[model samples]
Target: MDLINTCFEMCDYIEQNGVVRLAGNVKLRDNLKKELLHFLIYISMTDGRYGEEEKAFIKKKLGFDVSASMAADIKNRNMLGAGYITRVPETFKYFILANAGHKIKNDRYDNKEARTLAETYRKLGQEYLAANTGSTEVEINVLSSYCVMLDENLKSYGLLRPDYKSVAIQAETADEKEPDADELIAELNSLTGLTAVKEDVNALINLLKVQKMREQMGMKQTSVNKHLVFMGNPGTGKTTVARLLARIYKAIGAISKGHLVEVDRSGLVCGYIGQTASKTAEVIESALGGVLFIDEAYTLTNGKGQGDFGQEAVDTLLKGMEDHRDDLVVIVAGYTELMEEFLDSNPGLRSRFNKFINFEDYTAEEEVEILINNCKKQEYMLSRDALEEARRFFTERVANKPEGYANARDVRNYLEKAISNQASRIVGLKDVDKNILAMLEKEDLVGIEL
Candidate 1:
């Protein structure tokens, strides 16, 4: 049986044997039971369909079978609506632990099942602590079992044990040192290629710095919108540049935080009405003190007509940009032409995003440099002939580029294939030395088409 089925069986045993009883008031007990049932049903439905086994298990455990209509209502109410459980309250948490403990006893303390149960318990406990602040000392004691279980499970899984004391010391030794504006600019300049893009970013940084200085010197200053549009092809480093822009803004005091929250069309757009706004707002809230990087942003408007919720996502995003203009920088990225069409689709978008940075595709030489960097990162070396072959391969690949040609991403894939070929070549050799093991031969690059 799967984990959820096992949990249901344990719950059934507990209910029939009266091994654990709820100690709360009648209403609280009923609510906790309802929530617990909802959680089980939600978890079971995670695989996309509720089965006969699940229904039978629920009927046997809870003493009542739900009709098809009732089951649909439960799914729509809990999974589709606001009744989906994200946090475990104290009462529901106890119910889970009670059933888990009974399962452990019934299984005669089997280590494997115990370890799996421990992980589930720890996840739920961590969720509770994340959602609540003023937990009582007794409640803390209960949750502390989660950490104990985690440690035990690590050992059970034969993973390298963590050093908590050293971790705590290292965390305490950390300092909140912020990078200066020049430092961030230098970092941006150090990236390979993108000369024009770097120039535009540097100019914007200078403009922001001058504005800040003007404010300090008692001069009139205008409000500047920091929203941006990054137009580029796939693997052209749009996301990477967006990340650096976040740090640049933070260093120049334009934004409060330097973190980057990246999302695509699916992250913001939802299936139902009234949910797209909440979903988009939630993502924006997480990115409040940082940057929200929306990649392939043109896809947000790819829907057929008004039936699509993509427009709702765009409207919510525009509102977020206006409301959090000071601390949040939203960078929408996509292919150059599609991004332009997307901007023109909504006047509000074009008005808010005044700065446009175009990321050009990498040259064949730049692509070779990126491949070499990847090799160095993986501690692999290419023979002289192999290196020449790689350069020729990249030149040809870019010359005969396909529709979805990912510049850097394609290079990485080529390197990965070469590495795999090298592995297949060397895996059977018994007399291989360190140099032989680390080197990629020209033969490794012979059969790669792209």
Candidate 2:
């Protein structure tokens, strides 16, 4: 895989903050290489399958095939992380995480075994896959899981990411290219709808700027809670706005790094008793210097009562918020009524999150603008008739909008369906017409049900 080649390139030749040096050149005396191989095997079998794609990849790099017993051991054992990698030294810790920390099903993480330099990539991969799935949702993304682990490790090791092309530094890529406060605010204001949300964000930004200036002038300022509550339905750009806010905080030096770590109750509350606190703490640690955007935070306090362990997570989260008050901002979002109930359920939650911003549903015209924007992003165009049809479709849909309608998300689904319809119609054509391929006709939109 190309990733493996990049890792090799990094091993043979690399530069760290202007100093060029060869990494992984130090000799090792542990069973790190074999442990690393086993960790790779565990990640490859994550989805309950280890096909030829995985088998061949492992064999080529490790110089041996994964035996049947090894595969079974991976499946039978809880995971390969806790017992293998977290206890290693910084040299191997950095090496493992940089090379094998992240994985996607379609993407491959390949690297040669360089014993002289270091042979401990599996540690990162193992730490990532070490989340106790026994008590969490099955759909929790492996990539996100591993990424959170990698971030915690990076913070502990005091390391900075070199490049996005390098797997070891995946956490810092977003920050490296992040826009400043003005640019982020401009982007937020440029969204199709959410006029009220825009005004609210602007007012908050102004307040912070004045507060900073007052501090410079030796004027004592009251404590301001950076945490907020977002009241809106799904897909109303809550997460998007929260992400922009993170960068804005960083650009203004309110936070150390401006990364947004998004998670819901599923990412926080563990099924086990004492485990929930640690799990919640780990998630908070990853979000130390950024915003933690918790969607559907209402679920955590939905009358599940003390037995649910959701309360434990909430307690841990509150402690983390206070402990890292200077650097972390927490944004909890849900439907208007449910969010009210969530806040009502806890006194501390109500006190800490006094600022509330409501994201209104998009109007029909705004939905059409969103459609056009989506098309323009992918180099697709809607014919005049198609655009008019989209307008009518959204107008009627908005007039009779159902409960829990996902605003821009609905537009995205319609555009994707239109593309699929266009492909189906053009597939039988004898010649490939660039114009036909690029344009969405009226019938394409007409055929879409939503």
Candidate 2 Cα misplacement greater than 4 A, ranges: 1-178
TM-score of each: 0.60, 0.61
Runs off by more than 4 Å, candidate 1: 1-178, 304-306
Backbone clashes, each candidate:
0, 5
Look at candidate 1 and tell me the lDDT of residue 4: 39
Q: What is the C-alpha lDDT profile of model 1 across 163-254, one tens digit per residue?
A: 11122123233394465554444445545567667766754665565456556657555566788899989998888778778877887789
Q: Per-residue lDDT tens digits of candidate 2, residues 1-450?
A: 333344444433322322223357442322334544555655555556555545555676556586656776865673554343233433345454443533122222232222212212422332222322221122123322332333334423333221112221223564665454544554555566676676677656645654565466565554667899999887788987887788778887788988889999999988898998999999999999999999999998894655898888888998999899999999999999999999988899998999999998889998897888788777789999999999999998899987656888999899999999999989999887788889999999895775
Cα shift from native, residue 420, model 1 (Å): 1.1
* The 10-residue segment with the lowest total lDDT in model 2: 131-140
What's the C-alpha lDDT at position 331 in model 1?
92
